[model samples]
Structures are given as C-alpha cells and as structure tokens.
Target: MQQAPTVLHVGWMSRAVDALVRSGAEVTCAVKPADAPAARTVCARTIVVPDPTRSTDVLAGLARAGLAADAFDAVCSGLEFCLLDAAAIAGDQAGVSRALAMRDKFVQKRGVRDAGVRTADCAVLDETGAAATALPSFPQVLKPLDGGGARNTFLVADERELTAALGQPEFTAGGGPWLLEEYIPGVEFQVDGFVEGGELRLMSISRYVQNLIEVHSGGLVAHIVLPPRTHPELYAKVRALAETAFKALGHHDGVFHLEVFQHAEDGEIVFGECGARVGGGRTDEVVERAFGVRLHDVWARLATGRPSGVTSSPGHADDKVFGGMNLSARPGPVRAVPSAGEVLDRPGVVYAEVSAGPGTVLPDTTEATNLRAGLAVVSGADEREVEDRMRRLADWFAAQVAQETSDTAG
Candidate 1:
C-alpha cells in the first residue's frame, strides 16, 4: 500500500493549518515554542522552532533534532510566524538557502530595486549606528530588516523622534539591522493575489483609510476593499508592477502580498514592500468574499503539491461589492461588550468578530497589533452603502464598548 505524501508545515497560520489537514496530507506542524499548543490541535506532528529568522540556527537545530528534509514530500508556511523555518525545510539545503533570500525584507527590497522595480530609496542601518547616521529624509519609516505586521515599524518625523524610537525597548530587543525608507507620501494600497506557473492570478487591491504611521494620519487601522471606485485604472498598473515584483523576487508559485503607494500628487505607484506569503489579517477571507475563490485553498495545495480537490465553499459573483472594515474603541479598559450576533444585527453586516470583549484592556494604538478592536464583514448594494454601513458599525462598536468607566452600567 502506498503512503500519503508526508508534508512538513511551518508557521502559526491557523488558516493554512486547517486547510492542509483538510487536504489529506500527513502534516507535521512546526512553529515557535510559544505557538506549539495551537499547532497541537490540527497537526499530528509538531516541531518547536528556536530562532526562526536566522537560517543557520534553524538548519542546525532541525538537523540536530534528526528531522531530515527527505522525509517529507513538501514543506509549507503562510504567515510570518516561522515562515522561513518551513521554507528552509523544503527539498534540500539549497532550498533553505534560497528561502533566506525570499524571507529577508532587506534582500527583497534590494532585489526589486536592482531589477528597476521602482521601490522606495532605503538604507540598511544597525542598532548601534542607526542614531548617528543621517537619514535620507525627515518622516522616514523604520522597520525590522526581516519583520512583518509592523511589529517594530516606526515613523520618525525628525532626528529627535528617530533617537527615541531606536531606544524603545521593542527596537532594542528586536536584534536589528533595520530597514529605513523615505516615507512615501501617497495613498497606500495592499495588493493580494497568487502567482502560479509565473502568471499573476486573482489579483485584488485594498486601499487603507489612513496612513500606517499614526492614529490620526490614517494608519492600517481600517481599509476598504479592492479597486477603489475612483481609481479603476489603478488596477491594471498596480497588477503589472506586482507581477514584475513577484518575478524579480524569484517567486514562482505561492501567494504574495505587496504594499504600494500611489503618490498623492502625481498618482504614480511606488513599491513600499512585498512578502512571499498570503496577505495577513484575514485578507484571503476578504478576497474570497469579494471574488468567490479561496486563494488560501490554492496556496495550501501549492505548498503541499496536492491536487485541486478543494473542499472550501464557492465564491460569489465577481461584480458584487463587499467590504471588510475594521473597528475599535479608544485606549482604555473595556467595560461593556457587544456580541458578534449583536453586531451582525446591523444591515449589510454579513459577519463580525470582536477580539477584546468586556473587561479586556485594549492595547494602545501603537502598531496594527494593539489598534484593532473588531472587524465587520459587510456586503452592500454599492460602495456608498458599504461605506455607510461601515461607519455605522464603527460608531455602534464604540458605543457598545463603554471604554470610559471601569464598570458596565447594566
């Protein structure tokens, strides 16, 4: 009797884990020690990762643990959580070496710039010398050379701010060598899609309501669905740039997330960043709701080299407009809370999820991590209706969460 193809899965992407298990692969889940418990639920076999960002450490540890690469037919990951570790295990040592290039932010930024892909001008800076060196411009953004979800990402408005930011406990402990880029001044968009057999497939763009730098400047606290009604032509131009970027970065088959900026003045698109993984923050869900296809399913099959016998539900009409809007309350102790069922009572609200319930102290608006309170998945007859419903939902969520007092009135 033949055995099922053994697959080694990496990262804390629960969505990918569920998909892979459901896809019928002999899945061995590998993740950081902190994430092992969650991996235990779906994965029969789990490996604890030490330092995922460093390829040398990962390779040595895995070998010392006696987990040979040849034992598995494929290795896979999606989120930033231990993605490189999974990539390193695929096929052979050469595969591990190549995964470093794909996973490192500095390498990806440099690769695209070398290929004339029009990325922001950036310089690599070490923690020791970052403060002394003169930055390219004021209001520059600093991110970990190989980090994601804006964990240590900061916006420096001047020399004083840069110094303070670098001294922060987060940046100091992050072990950097960071990437600093001239903050691209423009309307930002997140393009999420798949590149299969060297072709860009099912590309969609999400526009942010605010800048990612701050609470007021319109950071990623909220975003609208793909193809802004005003900028239809942007779809073509952004897609082309994203395709060129994916190829230049040496990705053949996998999901890709590309953050880009359309200049506020001239409307020219500039590359902000790119990753060889599925779009974070349930973006694949938004994409599925919009187009009726599950990119996650495609990505899982691609990772495991399995046939396209997917069990995910079908998608809706491509023309139908759907919006995935995030909501939150002011920084304070959560007093009262609203149930998901209650939030869904609003018109056009198809689905909703609240992360912090009553009594949960919401994290401050630092990065994407602490800012979001809940998200509403709504479908409307048109963009205006979608926007209105989103606004209503936000207001309703704020009202629902009595952030001021320490106790609920009821």
Candidate 2:
C-alpha cells in the first residue's frame, strides 16, 4: 500500500497541523526558528524556514529551486497574511492552482463585489491627502489593504476622531496600501466554510459581541454560534449570505472564514472580509464541539483530494452556541498575580490560555489579542446558557487582577 502522502505546511505550528494529523497524513512543517520550539512539540518533524514575512522575492527564489520537491505531496498555507507568496511557491512547486487571489485587499474586496455580493463601500486610498480629506461620515473605518486580525484597523466617530485616528501609529502599519470604508453598525457574524469544485459548504456562523466599541478595537470577542433555533429566519439568512460570498469569491477546494455585519435596526447584512482558510483563535474547536462537524479534518481531506465529511445534524445550527473570548492586560505595572485557573473551571469552558504571565509588560497596539494573551472557548446547548457561561468565565478572570496603586505599599 502507498504510504500516507507527506503534506508540507509552509508556516508555523497551527490548528492546520493538528487537522492534517487527524486525516492520517504525515505532516512536516516549515517555520521560523523562533517558532521552532513550539513546532517540535506539535509535529513529528520540523524544518526551520526564514520568516515567511520578510521578503517575497527570497521566498519565491527558495520555492523555485532551493527546496526539495521529492519530499512532500502538496503545499498549503493557513493564515491570511502568509498565503500569497507561500501559495505562489507551493502552487509553483506542486504544479497546483494555488496562486492565491486574497492578498491584495482591493482585489479581494473587488472579487467579492464582482461576485454580486454586498460589501462596505471601500476604496483604496492611494492618494493619502485626498483620501484623508474625503473621510466618510462618523463611524467610518480605515485599515491596511492586506491586513488581518484587526491589525492596522482604525475606527473614527467624527472628523476630529478620524483625523486623530489616522495620526495613530497603528494606521500606518499597512506601510502604503490602505483603504477607507464606510462603517456599518450592526451585529457582527463570522462564517467558516469550504468550497469544492466551485461548490460551497457552510460550516458554522459566529455572532461576535465586542465588549468595547468599534469592529477593530482589539477588544474582547464574546460570540455564540448560530443557525438560531429561536430565530430560524435569521439563521437561514446568515447561511445563505455566506454561501453567496463563497460563490462570489470563486474559492474552491479549501476553507474560508468570512465575516459579515447585520444592521442592528434595519437588519441589513454587510460583508466584512474573508480569510481563505480555517478560522483562527480556537474557532475550529468551538465549531466542532457545537456542530459536531470536524472542519479541520474536512479541510485536510479536501486538501488531499478526498471527500469532505461535512454535514449538519437534526437541530437548528444556532440551537447550540460555542465561541471564544480574547483577553488582554490593562496597561500598568503588575500589582498582583492573576490566576487563570478559575477561568478554566467555568462550566462549558473547554479551555483557557494566558500568554502574558505575571510581570510581563504589554503595550497597546492594533494587534488583536487572539493569541497574544489567551482565549476561553465555551459551548452549550443554548445561546443564553453559553453566553452566561462565558460571562462567568470572564468575570472570574476580571476579578483576579488588582491594579497597582501609588498610595499602597509595594
């Protein structure tokens, strides 16, 4: 019998590795040295590659001739920012149609728009002065074209706010390519699905609740999975909208995470953006536990040219809720140690992660704390019950921290 094909993943250790392993495939990772230690713990073997972010030309050169082609079956990338060049390389080496179409923000949005999907009114702000002058009405958003995880995203409430926000260090992270878009106020939703041979399969929908204002505030994400039993119409709409998007993007044979916005008052759904792979931040875990669908396995299966085992059960999709909350440390000196153990014990919480230990200094940035700190995933049979569990878990963590005070003795 032929041995299981070796899959070459050109990035760090991630949920994708675990998925590949579950599909009975031997996985070899190519990642940066900084991520080597963690990669070793997860994969059977690892190859240290130069940081994928540094230079696209260097990566292309390595891919064109330097890397050994006899070692792997296929090339794959998981994250949004890492896809373009890696996909280009993998596609070149494996002779696959892996040339990615999602790296350019304008192109990505344009593709979605051309697919006849509804999206925010966005324009590439090439002329910085003119772009800055033509800021949309209050509550508009500014972000880098090829950005993700809320990185380089800015929200402005008014003219003054918009100007001040544009001046922030975060706004320039995009380097040059940037966009300004009209913000849509509404309930945020996320869809993680796959497209095969131009066919779209809906996996899960998550309703994101932000503890702080704005869509890109780097605040906590309190969410619940949907196909809402109490509101079947809403669930169907969300699912259909996502299907339309998948069809629009012309995405085939891989996972895609698309975010949408539903106007709170009018219920108008607006397309946000889509990641061409599995949803990050333990979203895969939540979807599997809540929906009984193994997306990681499905993605791996599809990646290896096999049938994806994906289906919905008897109940409505939103009948059960599952999602995660991102945590962050308030800016200040550590006054007391925070115990994450209490959060781990909360009902419905499958796991809790805390990256910032006691005395670790953290600075505010456009970076979302998806993995910077830690996340807690909660799943339950009902939305209220699930949200309640998450709130309880959040409260536990909140209570553990004590701010440093000048009046008190050290």
Q: Tell me, by TM-score, which candidate is best.
A: 1
What lDDT score goes with residue 398 in model 1? 74
What is each predicted model's overall lDDT from 0 to 1? 0.70, 0.65
Summarize candidate 1's per-residue lDDT along 1-410 as a digit string, tens digits: 12466777765667888877776777876667888899888887877767554556556656777888667788777665556666665645655545555677677777878877777777888754655464557878877787655677887888888888888887767677777877788888777777667777667777765655554343335556754454568987897788777777767677777789998778888888777667765577677787666777777776665543344433344455666766677777886778888888998887788888767887755555435777777777766777777778878887778774535544
The whole-model C-alpha lDDT of candidate 1 against the native structure comes to: 0.70
Each candidate's number of clashing pairs is: 7, 2
Which candidate ranks first by lDDT, i.e. highest?
1
Please list the residue runs of candidate 2 whose C-alpha ends up more than 4 Å from where it truly belongs after superposition. Answer: 1-3, 41-45, 54-66, 69-71, 92-100, 133-139, 171-174, 211-219, 311-320, 332-341, 362-372, 402-410
Q: Evaluate model 2: give its lDDT.
A: 0.65
